[model samples]
Target: MGNANCVFCGCIEQASVGVVEKWGRFDRLAEPGLNFFNPFAGECLSGILSTRISSLDVKIETKTKDNVFVHLVCSIQYRVIRQNADDAFYELQNPKEQIQAYVFDVVRAHVPKMNLDELFEQKDEV
Candidate 1:
C-alpha cells in the first residue's frame, strides 16, 4: 500500500504571483506569500506564474520607406495581467517568445512606412 498525502504547501515570492492546477487544469491564482492546496492523491500542482513587469529587448534590421536599411533596437515592457494569469500560463506555451513575435510583426509592418528621418524624429512614438 502507498502512503497518502493530504496537504501541499508552497510560497509565492513577494515579486511574483502563482497559479495552481489540479489534474493538469488551472484551479486558481495564488497571491504572494504562503499558500496551501489539497494534494488529492498527488493531483495538485502549483508554481510561480509571473513576477513584476518584465522587459524584452529586440534588435531588428529593416528597410525604411526611402529604401535605406536601418537597424533598430527596441525595448518592450510587459506583464501578465492579473485577471488573465491563468490564460497567460496555460494558453501560451512560451509567453516571452510570443511577445517577441508580436514585437517583430509590429516593427516590420510600421517601420517600413516611415523614412529614417521621420523614424529618428518621432522615436518615442514608435
Candidate 2:
C-alpha cells in the first residue's frame, strides 16, 4: 500500500472503514466496498479501521497483602464506534497500548489491598 501510482483501487472488507487522505491530510472515509481514488491528485488510502468487536488479554503482575506475587490475566473486549471512527483512526496512535495502561493502573491499585485468599475466592468475579 505504500507504493503509489496514478490510480489506486482497493476493497475494504465488511465491518471495516477506510481512512482516506488528500495532500497528506484527512479527506474522507470510505465505507466497506470497492473504492477508487486518484493518488496523482494527492489522494491516498491512509489506513483501514475495523468497526467490529475485538478482544485482547492484558496480563499484569501485582503483589497481594501476603506479599505473594500474583499474575493476572484480564480479557478486554473493545471496538471502534461507528460514530467515532475518525477519532479512533486519528486520536489513537496505539489503542491497545492505551487500554493496557489503563487496565494495569486499575488492577495495580486494587490488588495490593486484597489478600491471596480473597483474590482466589473472587477469581471468577475478577
Query: Which predicted model would earn the best lDDT?
Result: 2
Q: Give me the displacement of residue 78 in model 1, in angstroms.
A: 0.8
Query: For all the candidates, what are their Cα RMSDs to the real structure?
Result: 4.4, 2.7
How well does model 1 score by local distance difference test?
A: 0.77
What's the true lDDT of residue 69 in model 1? 97
In model 1, the clashing pairs are none
Candidate 2 residue 106 Cα shift, in angstroms, is: 0.8
Total clashing residue pairs per candidate?
A: 0, 0
Off by over 4 Å in 2: 1-8
Clashing pairs in 2: none
Q: The CA-based lDDT of model 2 is what?
A: 0.85
TM-score per candidate, chains pooled: 0.85, 0.79
